[model samples]
Target: MPVTPSDIVKFIESRPGRPLSAREIAEGLRISPSQRKKFYRLLESLATEGLVAHLKGDRYSLPRKQNLVTGTISVHRDGYGFVSPREGQGPDVFVPARFLREVMHGDEVVVRVERGGRPGKPEGRLVRVEKRAHTTLVGLYEQGRKFGSVHPADPRLNQPIFVPAGQELGARGGEVVLVAIDAYPNEFRNAEGHIVQVLGDPSDPAVEILSIIHKHGLSHEFPDDVLAEADFLPEEVQPGDLEQREDLRDLPFVTIDGETAKDFDDAVCLRREEGGTSHLWVAIADVGHYVKEGSLLDQEAYLRGTSVYFPGQVIPMLPERLSNGICSLNPQVDRLTLVAEIVFDAKARRQSSRFYPAVIRSRARLTYTEVHEMVEKQLAETIERYVDLYPMLTEMLALSEGLTAMRRQRGSLDFDLPEAEIILGVRGEPENIIKAERTKAHRLIEEFMLAANEAVAFFLGQRDIPLLYRVHEPPDLAKLQAFQQFIAFFNYGLNLEAEGVDPRALQELLAQVEGKPEERTINQVLLRSMKQAFYAPDNVGHFGLAAEHYCHFTSPIRRYPDLQVHRVLRQAWRAGGLAEQERNRLADRLPEMGEHTSRTERRAMEAEREIVELKKCQFMAERVGEAFAGYITGVQPFGLFVELKEFFVEGLVHLTSLSDDFYTYEEDRHRLVGQYRRRIFQVGNEVEVLVQNVSVERREIDFTLVDLAAQQTTAQESPKGRRAQGKSKKR
Candidate 1:
């Protein structure tokens, strides 16, 4: 029952001293979820009318209020910053440069709302800085006459940290150094720091990557205690290890992975059942068996969250001894595993599923290319090498197709976008940038893993267990509507309605636009509109996979959440329905754990992206004068960004380079049109460009527009003009 305005007022006033958040107010009013949007609007209206006080951090109280709002301040490189509210459904208040006297990015701050504005552009003034996100900054140290300055590795952290005389800590100019902040700047002076550690000169090829690693705060080397703990992990499965585990070493389980893959976390085997059904044995490496809870290894793994992968480097969550040796499901070696044994019906729906500890010796370690050759191309050498497993491989192909069809039919949105694959030399220099290839071999393993993950999540969720779920929330309504309007320009029918988004609708749109000229553009737009999937204690389901139940059940060697899930499941297996004590403890802590893992996961991603981007920038730096044909991917008032056809790099072509005519930006149309010549440059337009510059510091490549069309037109016109001039000269 929705409470009346009078009832809401009385409840709010009842808590006289303390403030009530929007969630609490809604709960008190018995407001259901469906009316949440409207309820928020009502609260906003009340606040605007001065009937209710919306105070600091969006908490509501009596009519008397303070203008201060508390949140995290994200300072833009241009000096301005935005403070996102800490407590309610409100806009991020923008703080001007003058008010941000000593603020840096990621500071917990209190802001005074000067006035109300649009949700996207609210105005505010900084009142106080509650907490500083970082005490140390990593960057290049430059020695000045009076003092040294630190150029931060992160470009967004634009302001240089000043180092006073004799505080350089023997760090020379152009060297990457870690600086510890001693003082934060005010309107009177610049922020000051002292050099703590010299990481080497930025001119060194390796130092660039080193700077990126430190900037993201990722730990690469394991601690001595953690490494010592890993030594206790068995090199091979012993009799004691398999005491309570089912012995399945005789089964022909095989590991399928890339040629360069060192750690094998999962292995699989299939058996055909009666009535056109199949049984899948997905044996995952038993990391929890070796990495006991509260141990040094477990602590380190949790801190890392997930392994970070670069072009030719991998920072493993666990030590190499565990990730690649004992815990890896190596062929011909007995490995302990937690298996999700599943039986699927003819329609590829899981009929029954069970999980238990097991020991398995993988028959062979197979590469994707080899599998593709054996299964798809029917290569003689491949068949002869694995002649005994040939029959099982063929059956696995059929099963994989069925599972793929089942997922697709359920409205799973699979984006087949091309991802960059950097080929590095022995010395780690990028030799070439190519799109990562996906074969049937990749899908075969993917389908099996997806099934096992879904099975485990469904089982745990049904039991009312508190566990981490890989959740993807639905897209924001405003972004979806904006996307719909943009796609309409291509005559594509993408009518996002008030009923909210569904995976099915997005899936249908992608299928319809496949192989079209606008395929990549539409795919990029739709992907941007979707929310990022992350770990959560509560299950809202995975939207992209169209899965009501989904979690990371495999790859414990690299991901912490998978290891956590394994630990929880193993305990439940022994104790049976976790006691109220354990359950309550998990319920209290899982949310925080989920948030930490998610942040670490994002940290790893940013580090990887930064490294790859730096390599791409370096590659483009050598070809500054070359010309290339590419397509316009983005358009803005200042310039258009074009993605190269062969190189796969995107660079900006500024509007000032349009020599034929002055171009004016059309914001709503997403295009730049010439004022006099009427020439147009729009997203998806093909054009030739000359590489203008590449800035390693900014991690940007620049291109200048090449007027091939105008050049050809001029060439044809010149001959006619020359012919008339010749006639006049002959007369």
Candidate 2:
């Protein structure tokens, strides 16, 4: 038999702690002369993937055997970076600034771990870059006497791209432009690139948002083939489309969403039975029916993975013809859907669930504000407007309340953190920033969706069907321990002797700090200590939700994983169960599908966050020198992050700006202390601050204390003041 990759790996393993050349490896396997070229290529490919390390003299060995590690490098704006291993579990290897001269952020590279480094963590130097993350970047073009350079919009990309005279594309000095890198940077030379697109002034709000879109590499426009396919789809559901779908047109179903929502993907109907049981029907648009597997539309949707929603714009996975037209569950229109019909007891505990295809005509489209007024406030005007649907709405409210109680009883975490809502002008400029409201009606819809998702996940998991689950693994022990230490400052404790702590323990701690002064700060820190939720093939369970089986089955119009779940459910339901062949096929592909969707979801979130910060900076630019009441939300070695009470905008108060006294950071206590005066700056400390500077391009806002002396006087009498004085006296 011909030699394979496994054969090569085995041969290399045989000679442990020794690097061997390709010729020797091939000779030991009795390779022919004709196979020499192919053999060398195979070895090179393995090295590129970090499976093997290529040392001097063209010899190869396993990466671990040579103290070499491979992974993507995430660079901080300060120039240092860390390499997270691609295929194993361990601490990330830290790479100092001097050792990162030849590599950029997000580049895949091999690192050689030094013998002596930071305690309990490995430090390394970049050996070779295996892959580059960016070939093109968006930046501000700065013209020089002889040539021009593009300063990257992303702060992690510290090096400037050198653009020669003729390659400037007629861009002005301060214009935002896109540049294609022809040569990457090294120790001896700067990166070289040519301007490709001039994207107007950076000060323009539209240009600022557009620059972020390009920086994240988000696909905003659909390809011609995908658009053509979307156009070919029917504008409305046809007669044949309802062949096997249950007709639920007479049901009083309604869609409750934001006033600005254009694409409605889910609708709900709840019925109260005589036996004190509730039957809930959640109907999700049947997007899988139109965007078949391997079709142009499906390919594009898979590539996008999830729709990216900006402040006033959205980059949808499918073309608008489908996302907002035929697939949207609009009121008074017959739309094809996949229904999750679940039965619940008086306590809102799920009794049984079934999935089926259906066709439904929604009775009305309601906004969250209206629903809140009708349900929570009991407004006569709002209830009179939807008089026919009020009884069902009341029943829905009861079911939602029961479900909320059940989840809370099971230790489901509700962070209840405030989010900023950016009010924009007609020209897309931010006019104001306010805290987003989360009313009972919002929770009602959220509870219904969560119930549907859990029901679907449990249904599929019981049958051992292959699908992607929304998994949130338990927090790392080290992180949990550190969190315990931090919360101890507030006289809070957790049982951390065991390997895994119960979710209810965390739930109780949150309850203890609910209305305390340090509530937001503690909540933020505990949230950071938990692991991020992601989609995976394995059923690891969701730690935050306290669910044994969980998956994304709602909102197929925006999320790809939900569409895949729908397809699998329909196939399995029609055939009574999935066959062995079908199961194997799905099992083989779901892992990769999960990974891609998770990555795209994170990318979209980052883009959304970046745009919001940019807009906040723009809004604050006009308010410089104005004082506002605020509180410190975060404390680090370098500075304090203060959030204004009026606008919900956060700005950094740098250490250098505190010229009155030199302060040292207390990492364990999360505070800053003065050397002589003994003033304390800690999390949750209220103060007055003035906006000093705003850089929209960098998405930064700088603040300074309005009156440091008065603040210090006020802090001198607080509980923290006593501790600071006691520590100073001890010193």
Best by lDDT: 2
| TM-score top scorer | 2
lDDT, candidate 2, 553-617, per-residue tens: 99899999999999889878988889999999988999999999999999999999998898899
TM-score of each: 0.88, 0.94
Candidate 1 structure lDDT: 0.86
Task: Assess each prediction's global lDDT (C-alpha) against the native.
Answer: 0.86, 0.91
Instruction: Looking at model 2, report the run of 10 residues with the lowest lDDT sum.
Output: 708-717
| Model 1, span 176-230: residue lDDT tens | 9999989987777778998888999775767777788788888978999999988
lDDT of 2 at 674: 96
Output candidate 2 Cα RMSD.
5.4
Q: Could you list the CA RMSD of all candidates, in the order they appear?
A: 8.1, 5.4
